[model samples]
Target: MQVHNRRATLTGTVDSWLDRQQAAQEAHEAGAREVNNHLHLLHMALPAATAQ
Candidate 1:
């Protein structure tokens, strides 16, 4: 995460869409006027047993 001029820039991988939204919400709660969420969703392959 990078912060400049009250803007929070987030760059990383998240497991779900909810996580990305939560990150932005937390940034706003932390007093960030602007939030740039550049979070990428990570899709993990499930194990054979789990896939079933």
Candidate 2:
């Protein structure tokens, strides 16, 4: 019973970690896309930027 409880605790901890990691990955990806979109919009607005 003790071993079983320990296993359960470890599993829960690992699951939580995985959830947090996935969320962080998603947030990072979203931020990167937002930055890219802003840059693209800026490039479109400025013709001089396109020349460089």
Candidate 3:
């Protein structure tokens, strides 16, 4: 019985850790997208500025 309980606890801990990891990955992807969008805008505007 004790071994069963221990296994259950370990499983829960691992599940929680996996959830956190997924959240972190989603946040990182969002940040990367924002940076990419900003870079794209900057690139688009550069040619106009240089022509003047």
Candidate 3's TM-score reads 0.31
Candidate 3 Cα errors over 4 Å, as ranges: 1-15, 32-52
CA lDDT for candidate 3: 0.30
Q: List clash counts for every candidate, in order.
A: 0, 0, 0
**Candidate 1's residue-wise lDDT over 1-52, tens digit each?**
9999999999999998899999999999999999999999998656677554
lDDT of each: 0.95, 0.30, 0.30
**Model 1 CA lDDT for position 37:** 99
Question: Which pairs clash (backbone N, Cα, C closer than 3 Å) in model 3?
Answer: none
Instruction: lDDT for model 1, please.
Output: 0.95
Q: 1-52 in candidate 3: lDDT tens per residue?
A: 0123222111122234445455445545544321111111112223445555
1-52 in candidate 2: lDDT tens per residue? 0123222111122234445455445545544322111111112233455553
Better of 1 and 2 by TM-score: 1
Q: Tell how far residue 32 is off in model 2, in angstroms.
A: 5.5
> What C-alpha lDDT, on a 0 to 100 scale, does residue 49 get in candidate 2?
50
Question: Order of all candidates by TM-score, from best down to worst?
Answer: 1, 3, 2
TM-score for each of the candidates: 0.81, 0.30, 0.31
